[model samples]
Target: MELTVTPAALDCFRQEWAFGDGEHIRVFVRYITEGDPPFAFGITRDTPSDAALTTVAGSLTFFMERKDVWFLQGNRLTIDCLGEDIVFQLL
Candidate 1:
């Protein structure tokens, strides 16, 4: 439950996904391990997915694929498959 992403990165995401009352933008992350640089890669597609969006305590969660679910906050995101190994801090 750690956070990665710089202020700039957060800004980029905010600007990129400025949803105006339609559907909440969902952030989906997956586990992609590479040699010497094992990390959880990010897949940000503008189009919506089959994943359902549920709001809890002001946090929008995508509970479709638990194996690769990305607990997101604003532009800040954290994936757990890597045991908090990979960080995508906006930078």
Candidate 2:
């Protein structure tokens, strides 16, 4: 699986999530629908497992469950922090 995140998105994530050493971003598929985009994504703090796929972009470490790879492959994600709301976009 491959993914890309924008600088603006990275900054937004940095401002929102504080990471301890060995901790990283975990992307999970929350829900899937018949509607547009078809899936809902969420972020949580976690450490990678042996089966997890990991990637580093800038100062961010991202981990995705191996089972999720087929779903997230080739995805581009954008994040924006608006006051207390964090917006996530998949392109």
**Which candidate achieves the best TM-score against the true structure?**
2
For 1-91, candidate 2 gives per-residue lDDT tens digits of: 4555556656666665654444578877776778987877778887677445666767678777876666656766555556645566666
The deviation in Å at residue 39 for candidate 1 is: 3.5
**After TM-score superposition, what is the CA distance of residue 22 in candidate 1 from its true location, in Å?**
4.3
Q: In model 1, which regions exceed 4 Å deviation?
A: 2-10, 14-23, 31-33, 45-64, 69-87
Query: Tens digits of per-residue lDDT for model 1 on 13-88?
Result: 3445442333343445554567544544554434345554333212222222333434443343432222323234
Estimate TM-scores for all models: 0.33, 0.65
Residue 63, model 1: lDDT of 26
- How much does candidate 2 score in TM-score? 0.65
- Compared with the true structure, the alpha-carbon lDDT of candidate 1 equals 0.38
Candidate 2 lowest-lDDT run of ten? 14-23
Runs of candidate 2 with Cα error greater than 4 angstroms are 20-22, 32-38, 73-91
